[model samples]
Target: MSEDRISRDTEVLVVGLGRFGSALAATLERLGREVLAVETDEYLVQQWSHRLPVIEADATNPEALEQLGAEDFQVAVVGVGTSLEASVLITANLVDLEVPQIWAKAVSAEHGRILRRIGAHHVVYPEYDAGARVAHMVSGRMLDYIEMEDGFTIVKMRPPRETHGFTLGESKIREKYGVAVIGVKPPGEPFEYATDSTHIGADDLLIVSGDTNLLEAFAHRP
Candidate 1:
């Protein structure tokens, strides 16, 4: 799904309260969004009932989803990945209900393809994504890495010495490195949006964005 699919005012319907589902629901709620979670396991329902709005029901059953008003939500997440059959069924039911944005978790490439063919608006491989992000972080100076669509990435990293004490325009970071410094966060101060006049400190953290390879090269600078 596109980034605009879920906004600050969106209420989410989360199916399958497993690890991925629970974390998604909890984080959404913590961020001040309303969430309704559905789980097949009674124990899981009971465990999270005190913390979130959860119900004990099988999401594979379209009737159950309808009874729980699944069709009423614009955004629905299928977090059942352990069993391929159950995951497919739940995603299909959401599709039948015509949910505007459906995000499904897939364990493998085949599973993701099936989910997309069956109308899942977005398919995420959490394990693979996390592994890739961690690999990038460990291999360079990046403290955080987010790979977006079409090989674009945004990273939080320390500024290289070549950029220290120079303004954005003076350093010509975009021209030389093929990347842009979006913002700078000096120690003990809030992050400020970068401009041509912005000066970077040696210890300041940078919010950089560009193509994945170019960002890697920029972040790897000594």
Candidate 2:
């Protein structure tokens, strides 16, 4: 979907009150947006009734969705992750309703492709992405990172003991390590961007950007 497809005035419809759906609804409400959430189960509906406009209806049922004014929503998110069949059917119904944008969650790459083919505007593999992130966090000293693209990344890493007490300019990290230090968080002070005079200290968290493998190696450095 385009960045500006949904504006402040646009209403959002979230189907399925699973963890992902409930969290999405809460966040949208927190952002001060009007949200309509639908779930087939009465218990799930009650759980989020106070959070947003909750409707107990089967989203895969086109008639049910229509009764809730689904077509009036600017965007719809299908968060049914357990059943691919249900996800696809709901996606088809949303398309039939002519919702401007529909985002659906899929369990695998194949499911994602199928959802796209069935008219979902965007398909997200949340499980796959979360698994990769968890693996990275458990591997070594790597704290966290954002996958910017295929070959590049931005990561947070704990400073190595070898660089202790060295000022950023004196160490010449960019010249030698081939990774640019974007910012650093000291023991207690707020994070400071990498400047000529910035000094490296123990327990400092460094934010660096560079090649993916190179950044991983830096993260694992002793």
Candidate 3:
């Protein structure tokens, strides 16, 4: 497959309408991209009617995917993590069909490596990442967050009450906490990213990006 020929605007086919697939389909559709999702179960397909063009078909079948104009889509995601055989088959089909970019979800590191060997452009371990997120949420003071990469994360958190009214510089957050305040969401204004002059307000939600440990420590700060 010639991966370099794939266009950015090409439609995306997501195989599987489970949690990961459903969310990915919705996000791609919202981004103004054409998305075709496939699920083996009729009930699951019905549940995602409002999200995208979902079809009741087994993704492991190359013919089923070809019927949905799979050739027209440059990107595809195989999200059937529950069944290793299904995931592998779907990925192989996508690769054989010459889909330029294939992303497959794997249950483990070994599975992910195997998927990549079969032409998956990227392998995602959703279960492991989701577990980390759940643990972060369960730990009080960590409101919400996203990891931009292995080293950095952007988190939305309520600053400790003691830090209210403190300017970014005054608080010495960057030096003391080892976190960079990327933005602040005040009561009535939009979010403001780090600048020369930004302060922490009582009602503000600090939008920070830095080391994960720093963010976690800030979360537990009293």
Candidate 4:
């Protein structure tokens, strides 16, 4: 989906109230978007209904989606990944409804390819993404990490001792370590945008960006 595809003021239709679906719907609501969630499991529908607007229904049936006015929604999210048949059927049904932006969750590459073939605008691998993010955090000084396309990454981490007490220009971090320090947050101050004259302090937090392996090497420094 394009960056401007989903506006904060837009209403979203979410099918399947599983862990991923419920979390996404709740987050969208928190972000000031109206969300209408549909679920096949009665218990799940009931459980999440109090948190957001939800109804119990089988989304695999195109007729059911038509009744629910799915076509009226500009964005639709199919969060059924456990059952491949169900996932594919729901995504296909959304396509038939002509939902302009469809985001489907896939458990495997094959499922993702199928969703894309059927016109799903976006496919998410939540499990794999979460595992990768956790793997990075547990193995290094990184407090947080976001892996981007083409091996690039942005990380929040503690400053290395080699960088302590030196101005960015003097340290030449990007030239030496191959990672750019984008921002810094001292122990109690607001985050500061990084500049050539910015001094690296011992206890400051750093937001760094670079190739993933280079980031790992930089973060591993003493």
Candidate 5:
């Protein structure tokens, strides 16, 4: 709904008209993007038909996707998270079609593993991201968290008061918190990932990566 949302008519194929997929399609449509919503459930297809161009077809079928002109689309989003079988199949089909950008919604680590193996360009866990953001808000440490793998995460946070004037090596975060300061974004400056000797400042945003437990522990430390 924001006026800043770009209105480009880029072609995007959407598989599975579930809650996530439907929401994605509607948002993209509002942004003036061409969305082709595909669903295996006839009931869901009918429900969203009024607001979207619905196709009641199984995305597991490679031929169905081909007929739907999925390969022609610049991007594809597979949002069947409930059923791992369906999600994996649809992701594989998209890969086979050579979709340039394939983003799949994964419910679990195992599900993400299979999706990536089959060639999902990006795997997202909506629930996990929301939970992490909420957790950070309560602790007042991280601005955001991005999961890189099952156990590892990247955390964005302002430099702690204790680390206000210390250089990266002086802080000894790798030894104390078991995290690596990968990048720093100072106020009004572009992010720098190669800053090892740069001193931490009150306004500098630190990007660090470590296990979730380690990151959370560091975030809550006094």
Candidate 6:
């Protein structure tokens, strides 16, 4: 979805209140958006009912979704990844309702592809993202990591001690390490993408992306 797509509506229908769905609903509500959550788990529905409108029903059932005015929602999220069949069916139901945008959580790459084929506008692998982040934290330099397709990654990290006195042009990071320095956020300064003249600072956080092997090489010291 385009960046502007988020402006479509603040009302979001979150189907299946798993960990991801529940957290997403809560966050959206905190942002002052209207959240309507659906779940088959009666206990969770009861637990969250006071916080938002929780409908206790099967989200895969088109009848229940339609009754809740699913079509009126600009965004719908399907987070039932445990059961592949159920996740696909629920996504299809949301599509049939013509929700403008749908975000679905998937357990694997195959699941993600299926979700897209069935009409989910975006599919995410939360477990994979979390795992990559944790791995980067335990490693060196990497403050954050985003895994991209084909074993590529975008890494945000503090400039190494060796970079304190060098300008980005002088650093020759792209030439020396084969990883692109996409952006930089200096201490007490706004973040900006790279240009030859941008001076590197001791406290700056550099954003870079490239092959996983190259990123690991650039960050590895021992």
Question: Which candidate comes out best when scored by lDDT?
Answer: 1
Instruction: Give the clash count for model 4.
Output: 0
TM-score, prediction 1 = 0.92
Instruction: Score each candidate by Cα lDDT.
Output: 0.94, 0.86, 0.85, 0.92, 0.84, 0.86
Which tens-of-lDDT digit does each residue in 141-215 have in candidate 4? 999999988999999999889889998999899999899999999899999999999999999999999999999
| TM-score for each candidate, following the candidate numbering | 0.92, 0.91, 0.86, 0.96, 0.62, 0.79
Q: 76-118, model 5: which lDDT tens digit per residue?
A: 8998999888899899988888877889999988889999999
- Kindly give the stretch of ten consecutive residues in candidate 2 with the minimal lDDT sum: 1-10
Which pairs of residues have clashing backbones in candidate 1?
none
Give the per-residue Cα lDDT of candidate 4 at 37: 98
lDDT of 3 by residue, 1-222 (tens): 466777667788899988898888899888898888889998998888766788898878889888877877778899899888999999999989888889899999888988989889989988898888878868957678788788798888888766788888778888888998888889888877866478888888888889998889888888
Best by TM-score: 4
Q: Which scores higher on lDDT, 1 or 6? A: 1
The superposed Cα distance between candidate 2 and the true structure at residue 148, in angstroms, equals 2.5
Misplaced by over 4 Å in model 1 are: 1-8
- Considering summed lDDT, which 10 consecutive residues are worst modelled in model 1? 1-10
Q: How far is 109's C-alpha from truth in model 3 (Å)?
A: 2.6
Clashes of each: 0, 0, 0, 0, 0, 0
Candidate 3, superposed: residue stretches over 4 Å from native: 1-8, 46-51
Better of 4 and 6 by TM-score: 4
lDDT of 6 by residue, 117-156 (tens): 9899999999988986888867888888887789889988
Q: Please give, for residues 185-208, the per-residue lDDT of candidate 2 as tens digits.
A: 998899888997989998899998
| Residue 180 error, candidate 5, Å | 17
Which lDDT value does model 1 have at 162? 89
lDDT of 2: 0.86
lDDT of 6 at 199: 76
Model 2 earns a TM-score of 0.91
**31: Cα error in model 5, Å:** 1.9
Q: Better model by lDDT, 1 or 4?
A: 1
